[model samples]
Target: MSDIFEYAPAPESRDVVDIRPSYGLFVNGEWIDSLGDERHKTLNPATEEALAEFSYATPADVDRAVDAARKAYDSVWGRMPGRERAKYLFRIARIVQERARELAVLESLDNGKPIRESRDVDLPLVAAHFFYYAGWADKLRHAGLGEDPRPLGVAAQIIPWNFPLLMLAWKIAPALACGNTVVLKPAETTPLTALAFAEICRQADLPPGVVNIVTGAGETGQALAGHEGVDKVAFTGSTEVGRLIARSVAGTRKKLTLELGGKAANIVFDDAALDQAVEGIVNGIFFNQGHVCCAGSRLLVQESVEDELLAALKRRLATLRLGDPLDKNTDIGAVNSAAQLDRIRELSDAGEAEGAQRWSPPCALPDKGFWFPPTLFTGVAQSHRIAREEIFGPVLSVLTFRTPAEAVEKANNTPYGLSAGVWTEKGSRILWMADRLRAGVVWANTFNKFDPTSPFGGYKESGYGREGGRHGLEAYLDV
Candidate 1:
């Protein structure tokens, strides 16, 4: 589905089209400079360069975006027939596929995720999200939730920097398909793809103010969540911030959904295929530089084969290529930003300081980029800082379990119950562990499996609400 002429210059070209961090608020289908006093630089995590400058939306601007979304929700989007709405989503999906290459490249260059992942995981899931939700536009009556689950009016959504477009799609597709207009704020580290999506909305001839995107930091996000005009608030990020958002929306009429952080446990039983277990462990926490809400950051290995598995994991990690996200061969890219790199460093240091045996694969990381060697800390006790806290980087905390009961207890020990992996050949053990693990997603053999038709979310401190599948529509509905 790709061609030689699909992109600018050849694949070897370094300097691609520059989309400076846009300094404006997308409101009423137009991009206008924010009436704010401050601006921020969105950095290229790979090169540690300020790739673009962005304007911080003041509380007033957030109100304006909410007003615009409210106006569109009541006047246009809300009134549009389900079939007509479906057409717009279909158009957007087509445009995303047509320009998939550019989006894939832009996402990689901004978020510092491998281009292969952006192309494969992020982009396809984004497209499929739209495609899956689009069909439901006219089929809401048969959704099984109610006679008709109507829109929740205007939604204020805050997405993380890791999977910019994919996260955006997860929020917006369902909101729009269910007839809700949105005011979205992407993370300061990676706002490019979301801004690009605004252009895609325009290309799709989507109704004005139906999907407004505002780019900024925490203050902007706080303004969006606390604003009186928003009918719903949904966020995907840290549990700390999620708690603040929850507090802000406490007494309000607004519906809320939070897809916060995770410290998932990937448990490998003695019966697990050794090679496959190694691959699952590597992919679990190392992918996307481990900037995942449901990342398997904790490894719970059966004591019998713990040494063998750890050896293989370390060796496999060493072979991973770390470099430019744009490079096809770069298996692991830099962290999303310098701050994130610092956090990873700080956490890694804490692991060592706390007396855990920390090990980083002896891979040469690029000096210019915000890179951290894929790190693993063994002998990690549940009480250790590295084992308990969410490092949110390419860092894995390894712990051992002597029995099945101990494994389940350790796996479910964290406040996060977002996801957990069980690698085993035995069907009985797979189902047994799946039943015991208090995770929203139980990856029996695979590590990170996602689809638009599959439900995803977290429990406990990891936050609440489902993001995908037929059930995802609940968050946007009046029911």
Candidate 2:
């Protein structure tokens, strides 16, 4: 932590926008006070400094947001022509691009990811999502749904902290494409980008109350999830929370889609392209400091390749640079927040206590902020907690497979079925493994590749529905 603050201060930006330190709930197309006076400060996980303060939306505030959404659905959003809705989405996409720098900086500061990723990956994907869905706004009649397909009305959406602005686009773009009003809640740890999205909406001339942002912890999420006025609920978070949402909307008329936690298996066979496999494993498990829900937390290798892979992986992990997220060369950033850091620490400790051979690359972690070295554990069993549970961090648990059949069995052994990766030269094996793997998304010879046209989600306890592509509209469309 001390090391984090000890670094020289970042130079004053030449950019025009001054990042704000406080934000309010955006409801009815306006920034309003929380129904209660309570507030929570969002922090820079890199520096442990408060980057901004955001309203803690209460139950009453949720009611207000939902009512505003309902009003918008009836008076403007629902009645608006799909082409007009398409134009709004286009406008939002343009605004997002025009203000991409501001968003990327704020996202990096609050979420502690590299500025490059926020700009290149998160912001671009966000804008692309709107652009892709925008085209669909007027084409729903041809979208394979019945000719008279209608919007789901008011949608209540909750996004996780990992990819704040982009996830917001994933939820809002499709809902708007289908003509549904939205009440969105950004994760407590990273609310600045969502508030920034509200400002973008303001610039786009999006109708009052079409898109609303409420900031709070899990309780605020519960209010939105269970709100009677909400016609649909979309959530992205932990599997445990997703299950609660599943049960909450069980007997109700409200529709539900949940994108939850994953403990993905990245399998490297003896025949894999070694360099590609090494890079894939690194990116699969270490990107975003390993906070991704679809993070490949478990490393599955053919027994014959285990020793060679570990040697290369250890050498590669050792070379990664870690520190301030804004640094041009920083490959790993701080964990999202204190609580998330604790979770990672506890799991890593469990790895050591449970007798796995723990090894973290030699790197310096700042004392002023949450930081953990890129880690790996060898000699792991499927029954081990390190291998079975979703640590949601940079830690990877290693297990060796003697055969392809055993690999498939071990990969599907977990409660989660979010994603998996297979590295092999055999064409038949790729399709066969893809068939046997019980995951929503499978990467063959690649990992973590995402596109707006490709739907991404999980199976089993990883929750339901899809978040991108033509299939993504299912969550917001009326059957």
Candidate 3:
């Protein structure tokens, strides 16, 4: 493929980011060593290169961070005028915009996502989230929740590695905007950007302890989520983990919100614009190496057009460039971690064992790094694990339906219902489908589209509570 075009590698220069050799927990607006000596190395999935080492947050360290947040809330952040808090948030948003390129490069380096997506999609949304929530800071009384919504103090937020910086923004911006302080733990695999965000808080002159960053894995998140001082817990990851956190916080007064896993369905009707629908299908599943919680991992096409759509979709998959997260032209980058890649392979193999036909384009992958070729499984039954479970990779399972009612039934059959997409030219049909889908978000002709002002979450085992929009404010509020 390279010989055909003689394409040169256009790797984004990592010189844009200055990652520290090691990092400590950010507590009370200062960097301090962990109480324990245990440390873990954060690696780049693209090359398995050690990017940085970060100390794990011990239970004591989590307590210190939570205490700091609580102290800040009681002494300063809670008493701070909404207008003043808005100014701080606005400054952070402006700084994020100014350093967009740096954050994008760092995000790609740390998380193994294409620089194009990090630069164009994640960074922009992160800044916009802050800007959007900044406006809401001073206007909560008019947000329809109550006459005067009050902040839930000392929120503890645990985010996933898939969209490290963007998830940070999603968790932090609204929590801060509602006049609450936060103790946030970035996923152990992708903590660089969050540490960099601590720098942003310092640049904005945010009050000490107003925002703290703890870098660690599941144990650290467990400690933070179960801490008694924390008033609220917001988590984004797997539903299994969400259940554990829910149990840990049970019988407590702690308010909780979860944005967990999904196995979204992208439906293509015979009347849809075939070419655009194919594009949506590709973007929905292959974007971010299919690491999205709301990724359209399943394709439910009207039976009349299944063959045509599958042929067109395979052709589109052939054109996807997979390699080098720093490359400007790469479409699919490395999977986030070795564990995630193995999970994808296991589920894809199960798809084959369960009698589904699997296919991939004749594209060569890099000898090094964690990568999975864009794949699609046809003749997938609802009983197939590939169709029922979240693969979280660049894989799609295709199924067919005979009627709108059948499509609705098939799409809603999953245990997860975070998001769904329907492609059709008929406006009435689109509305009808949207009204019947049991998901938080429905895209009529588009797929994987997001906005800072729009609420996004899930139903059923996909977890509860919404993030973004006016509804997002309620999660951190005590009306």
| CA-lDDT, candidates in order | 0.88, 0.90, 0.94
| TM-scores of all predicted structures | 0.96, 0.96, 0.99
TM-score, predicted candidate 2 vs. hidden true structure: 0.96
lDDT of 2 by residue, 328-349 (tens): 5678888998888899899889
Q: Candidate 1's error at 228, in angstroms? A: 0.9
Best by TM-score: 3
Q: Return the candidate ranking by lDDT, descending.
A: 3, 2, 1
Model 1 over residues 1-479: C-alpha lDDT tens digits?
Answer: 66533223223233544575445778889989889768877777888777777788888888888888988988999999999999999999999998788889888888889888988888888899999999999998888988967899999999998789999999999999999999999988888888889989999988899999988899899989988888899999999999999998998899999999889999998988999888888788889999887788999999999989988988899788778788777778888877888998998998999889988877787779888888898888899988888999999999999888899999999888899999888899889988998888999888998999999998898888999999899999986
lDDT of 2: 0.90
Q: Which stretches of candidate 1 lie over 4 Å from their true place?
A: 1-22
Residue pair clashes in candidate 3: none
Residue pairs in collision within model 2: 1-366, 1-367, 1-368, 1-369, 2-367, 2-368, 29-209
lDDT accuracy of residue 428 in candidate 1: 91
Poorest 10 consecutive residues of model 3 by lDDT? 1-10
